[model samples]
Target: MSPMTIDSPVAGTAPATGPAPAVRLRGLTKSFGANRVVDPLDLDIAQNEFFSILGPSGCGKTTLMRMITGFETPTAGSIELDGRNVDGVATRQRDLNMLFQSYALFPHLSVYENVAFELRVRRTPKREIDDRVRAALELVRLSAFADRKPAALSGGQRQRVALARAVVGRPAVVLLDEPLGALDQKLRKEMQFELKRMQREVGITFIYVTHDQEEALTMSDRIAVMSEGRIQQIGTPTEIYDTPASRFVAGFIGSCNLIDGVADAATGRFTIPGVGEVPVDEIPDAAPGTPLTLAVRPERVRVLPDGARTEGGVHLPATLTQRVFLGDEWISHLALDSGIVLSASVPSGDAARALAATADGARVTVSWHPSDSRVIPTGELA
Candidate 1:
């Protein structure tokens, strides 16, 4: 296949001007025999941006990152780094570093030696290497542990040492492939903020690949959701979460309740087969009677006693089937009259306590404002 030019701007990224983007891909594609792992795609990552490639396993996210790092060759199209085409560049000469989930720290080497390994290989002057290594260690807050070996440090600290090594050379960009996947939950959360702080302090472009939705949302300046070798959506975390471009995005980014029904445009409502019509803030531009799907986040739903009045809000009859306590909040599961199950998240307070007091199978109503629900076309429900 020949390289194709991309005239339109990449999704969720501004058009490039002034200085070129930190990374650019035009019609980048990869295939192995009959299997296409990455379809032709266009994207631009700005300098100093914390970008994330998010998707489940086998969704081509890791393969795409490898192609960018020159570990895997693309079947077609081109890649540009800092406006320099690097289609055939060797991995080491790409002016970038990659940090893997495994610390990859030399167990026998001290933290300082491990961080100084790259410069030593390049025959960097001793004085310059010392200065850069100290700066990198200081940036990651590992200066005090410079003499410790990998086994002597905690998981988080070892990861920081690996991070210091990756950035010690001051590479133009860093590709992190689930670098925090090995840490404990609490340590993972701590390192998320630490990674963000290091990124800001160093001002280097970071392309993180992960399947954790919360992790991506917490650290990314922008995210590209991928599936079936294609980009499903690209936008800031708020845009991707609040205004998902497709049904896949809405359901994948967070916990959402999807309701399929036909749109009654004339009445500005959506009509579910047995649950009745519910008011919607904006009816899609399709003609009346068009099949559509409404997505509502669990937190937006409220569980109330049966026959409760819900003026100016959409409500549906349901039976409280189960309630789960999740430390900070409670998740109540309700079975709608139409056989659909909806979940409502309530903070651990009077409202949640009241809802939990209700017996299993108690009749109840679930309600939410029309503005909190998003409408999607039925055809895009995948």
Candidate 2:
């Protein structure tokens, strides 16, 4: 097989960054009969980087993680960890640990024993085991619960125990598969920060898998967005959200209004069947009449006040069809006279109040700058 090259804008993969990556996968693929779950996947994760594999269900993220963990052998490809090919290495022998959604603690064991399980199993000195166990518990803010059993801890506390156990061995990487999935929304949000802090303090690579976009956005240094057995894009959260490379990414990372049309290279405009003669700058380098899609985030769009005019942006006559107040902001649903529908987010306070006061069915205009929107091939939308 030829040398694998990851062409995406992955951080720390350039020639100037020396030495081996924390984890590398080349042509990684998994197939079951007629179905290919992960197809020709290649990736490089840097040491101490919080990398996340984000995709919706059935997108093969877990299978890919299993391949790295040695729990599931790849049908074809190679996995290298810190410069060593680990394709045939035993799961337990790999220098990494995995934490699952269920916490998976030993119910019969005390919290101290649970955190110390791996060390005890390996027959470490009793004195060293006690010291490490106490330190790990303190690291996770669970030292007070050391004598308690799994049944005596809260969901979040149990998760901390799992994290402590995963890092107690000082492994090269920590594989977290939806470790926050079992917690309530408030607790889940709280644990996101906790996990990030833990990973930083431990100074180990983290390969997290989750379908939740917010979780990936909040905690990852770099994210690999996957879909249909392949990576759609890989970049920082801001890069993925602000300058998505494809329609799927534009729509998936957060809410965005995707307007399908064909570009007019000569006029620097796009023509949609419902919305006519939309002026969009920075059009992708394509010949006139090429199919294109305009992507603009909801927050970037604005509902122009009565008789308000835009200086250098596109505007269309629209009607306020629905409005929702979300405390922190307001969502205004609109329909254009030409049949296009879109949404705009108004911040709370005066602006939201004004939009909220506007009667439904009132005429309005929605406008956005060309720079605030992205143009991509129309066929990229999922």
Candidate 3:
């Protein structure tokens, strides 16, 4: 409602330089009656960048995307497209296209006709429409199936046709809301790369929204993790996975073992209630006895034989409670004497075979490098 202004750069947003971003949000807010669906938010999606908004159901990801598309009016804040404010613009007038989970293809229309539908509605010249339709079909690798109807195509092919149609007009931005959700797992995985390739070839900005973490990680140039109608963190896949900004981000993005403890800056250690203190790389700038949470990825945890020699790492004794094989990798669940469970993932090979041979309830030692674990203030940004 107020004029959009940035007194300071929004956290995790790209620095304002070079060209204007494809999409920008300042103090964006949306609500239904007294309940807020999206909180005051600020974000910048760069031109031609593949950005994803990821969160669980009811986390406001869909609402946020709808606001950007002009379907839902924001209770506050402004939506900018290529640096132009479009707060009052109708959805059809915005320079963007959206693809939904449902292919939404006309059952009786041929693939070529589906891709040409938008251009036809715009009343483009016949020659231009033909060129664009062929190009769009070719881009999605559906040229050969141009004559096929949607009912005759595979789930993946129908999705491709939907994508071709969405991008046929060459809108500056394409918003995909879980477009691959209807496909089988294998097909969904395959489509992830296809979507990325299509975006790059078209050189169009893509704003993807999904609950699938792997989908976002594989296709997005950057990701915004959301929770409770607020953004938890924004960063590249590696940054979000390796150095999560909050406990929620750490646990939500991947399988992370979280341990609550108190920081002892003087000793450079974290003191767990039941388990003893463990070495930590750095301590937060908080007073002594401040609660902190240590986050360690399952792959980073090492399961060693009890009393095994460990150097320059935090080690604790535990019992091997369970081992689950996942083809390429094995997950070993170890329970500490304090009743805390930690999981270790090992590649399926000699080490994994050896771990599998270890009997359940056998004493084992779990160790991890201090550098591999991240410490954040407990309950901060959760």
Candidate 4:
């Protein structure tokens, strides 16, 4: 793909120049026949922020996106854009554009016409329409293919044409609904960077929705993880990944080893069934026997020889059940004596080579620093 160029904001409109957020939801919600898809939700998306709504399928992310685009009316509360209430505003009246997984381009029209369709419908002057369409095409690096029909373009090219169409109007926010779902892995990765760059160059707020964790982590300035009609947590990628506020957020963002336990606040230790007491850095301000769920990322756990000292770490005796080689890291699956499972990640160098040389059923001790464990409410374990 050629380097995309974004010269200026859409022809007639200036960039969103404000300290106010681009979009805000106050008590926003939606329900269907007693099933609330999106519960009362409040979110503030800043101007030019590449915010992503990430969750599993049926997690209300799409419904939330629709509410933002005005396609779905909220059951209660208000939708605001640029600090102005947009209640009862029609979809077309909202300052936003939506791009879906499918490239909804007109097959009979050339790329140029497809991109210019919106301008024509709005009765924009012919000169302005011509200039905006060309500019959008160039921004996506599809200017050379402007004369081609949708059928003549590849899947990525077709999608870019759709992007051009949506962005030519210079909406305050662009809502993307798994827009890269139809592409292969390689193309999807390439488009992630391209989308981020296009967003930066155009200086438009992008609200991307995806189930792919890596995609959200790669492209978003911040992410909102949703589940069961509510947000689990909202934060930057590192914060979400490193310090998930809930069990759902920890497991959803990446692989984790969640152990059920009861904490002894006085001793700063948590006791797990089948495993011995585990060290906790700071005890929660709870009773001595408070039930807690401890979460540790797979990569945070260290594997050592069976007799290695476990000082300053929670130690568990285990036997390697399996090992899988990822390009950059090796995953060692271990089964604890208590029958619980744990996954430990070994970097793809000496440790990985050493583990690979060890027998599959060899004994090992898994340990993690007390600070590496995140303690959350035991209710999430249910």
CA-lDDT, candidates in order:
0.86, 0.84, 0.87, 0.85
In model 1, the runs with Cα more than 4 Å from the true position are: 1-17, 285-291, 378-382
Instruction: Report the poorest 10 consecutive residues by lDDT, candidate 4.
Output: 1-10
Question: Candidate 4 regions off by >4 Å?
Answer: 1-18, 283-290, 380-382
* Residue-by-residue lDDT tens digits, candidate 4, 291-364: 77789889999888896876677778899999999999999999999999999998899988888898989999
Q: Model 2, range 1-382, lDDT digits (tens) per residue?
A: 0001111222343332467898999999999888999898889999999999888899898889889888899999999887677867777767777776455788999989988887876787899889888888988999999999999999999888888888887888888888899889999999999989988987999999998999999999999999978998999999988988888888889899998888877787788886688777768877777778899899999998755788897888899999988889999998988788899999998878888889999999888988888888766533
**TM accuracy, model 1:** 0.91
RMSD of each predicted structure:
5.9, 6.0, 5.8, 4.3
Give the winner by lDDT.
3
Cα error, candidate 4, residue 163 (Å)? 1.2
lDDT accuracy of residue 82 in candidate 4: 75
* C-alpha-based local distance difference test score of model 3: 0.87
Q: How many angstroms is residue 130 displaced in model 1 relative to the true structure, after the best TM-score fit?
A: 1.2
Clashes of 4: 0
The digit string of per-residue lDDT tens for model 1 on 92-145 reads 767688886555788999999988887887788999989999998998899999
Query: 270, model 3: CA deviation in Å?
Result: 0.7
The TM-score-based order of candidates, best leading, equals: 3, 2, 4, 1
- Write the number of the candidate with greater TM-score, choosing between 1 and 2: 2
lDDT of 3 by residue, 338-368 (tens): 9999999999999998998999999999999
